[model samples]
Target: MDEIEVEAVDTLDPGVARDTAEYVLYGGKGGVGKTTMAAATALASANDGTATLVVSTDPAHSLSDTLEFDVPSRPARVREDAPLWAVEIDPDDALSQAGMFGQDGGFAGGLDSLLGGAAGDTAEDAAMMPGADEAAAMQLLLEYMDDERFDRVVVDTAPTGHTLRLLELPEVMDSMVGRLMQLRDRLGGMMEGLSGMFGGDDDATEEDQFGDLDAVKERVQRLRAVLTDPTRTDFRVVLVPEEMSVLEAQRLTDRLDEFGVPVGTVVVNRVMEPLADAVDVPDEAFVEPNPEGCEFCSRRWDVQQAALAEAQDLFREYDVKRVPLLADEVRGEQPLRVVAACLD
Candidate 1:
């Protein structure tokens, strides 16, 4: 495969730049290049002099491989030349360290003693809920958003199913927290009576436990607000040039709309374009693939064209960008720069 030498442009075209949002999230079906797109965008933004952090919420992390940087569990600079940082969040670790259910079972044991173990079990069950890992990962994302070290945060979210569940987590967690708080309120007198009987200082401990719950509720509200605010966030759906990918992107878009999260960009990755048209070159500088001579190329191009048509119509109202299928894997800064230029 012949490689095209992509020249470095001093500035991204203003009209094509979508880096205005403080938080940009790329999400779609699995293996559709969301990580590549997110890495490219973060690199571009950082090159443009913005302090950018690229975060991977997907359990199957690929940011490290895509950027060719050893990304840590916590945010760290990926490139010395550019203001770029990256982190592949470990959700389980985060959850364990979050103190959500209290440290060393102190609060949990207290709750159990107060309510005959039912309250503790309920709290533990909530913490181990279906989307608990995602919730933990999202909490880390929220913290990064507020971090003063970076001006912009690009998120490579999990695939469609996990992404949708992550979006729903704020409301689900908020409701759960509210119920727990209410329960605490109703059991206040009972807890006090029991504490006096056992000669334990349960009042202060219970107050502290409920305080943590209040803090979590506040953060959930803030996350929801940031997601819905168009100026602050942009949820970009990435997909490949295939019928199934297109349909999945559409479904993701619909769900994002339902969540009131701003969706302004749709990135169609791996679109089969003419080799000559895919890269920057002078007229007749590169030989174009003769689809007529290659039946497989011709058939694949036809399929891509059909999918592109449907995607264009489905995402007509949004800013749709197409990334031509490249001859090489998009790894390291150079390839990421090429992908970013294509994005422009």
Candidate 2:
């Protein structure tokens, strides 16, 4: 992680090896190639004969589109006998199972009864609040992490803002669960007292009522630990060669650092060709037939050059991988393998 000068290349270098990290999370601004990077990495891992599961936590769920395969909530193989699997998490289903409307019918149902059947809108609103999708996605990730099915997990996260919020969820949820547990205990104590006086069983059964809350709290703690552990987890950022993209990447890099997550590499996607350097001709002779032949390409190439330079300066301390803009859309395993080759 030294400050090294990075020059935009036509292809990507083999940055971080997949087997080394149990969980690799790719995150950045939307349309910055996060899904593409994740797909390529997973494809490479599968080619290496390692079992890999690529999970899409982004609600938009474009991993299916990128892979040109139908990805279900449960892991499905991308090809016959392939070691690769992919899934777009069903967020709403995950939330319902783990949220207040869970099997226990615990908090939400209780509120509905307490409010004399006026809890419909309130319960819906609770689910719509921020972090709901993150919590649900976390639950899905935890299940995969605990399963012995995949050797490694690659996460294609949501956009920058949503991804940051998701990363912060563990801490926020832990505190909230702790307070709720405390209140449940207090209520259980009073219930036990009343039951004893009413000649009911003296056993304190109410303590078991908060089992769902305890389960959620435990899962959050485990995920938090894994995320902060540098050896097991690495956060790789993806971005386009643009001023705004670089600034957002800088902010994400700083925030991940503050959260104790290790960022191994930054992938600068869709880098324009070095128009001047790539052409082998005299400056004067290259005029009309040059890369600046068209007005649009000329303006774009100029902007891209400045943004690329800025990215190098801003992320000098991290490994930077550049992916060229392909004329053909990157889709399916074959296309992803081409990208994987660039990454290699």
Against the true structure, whose lDDT is highest?
1
lDDT of 1 by residue, 1-344 (tens): 22222223333332224478999999999999999999999998988889999999888888989998889999999878879999999977766655553323244345556677657545574554445456667878888999999999999999899998888878777766776677768777554433332233445575555566678789989999999999899999999989999999999999899999999889988866533443443334222445678988777767777888888889999988877666678898766776786676
Q: What is residue 213's positional error in candidate 1, in angstroms?
A: 1.7
Tell me how many clashing residue pairs each candidate has.
Answer: 0, 0
List the lowest-lDDT window of 10 residues for candidate 2.
280-289
Runs with alpha carbons beyond 4 Å of true place in candidate 2: 1-19, 99-129, 189-204, 274-290
lDDT of 1 at 320: 86
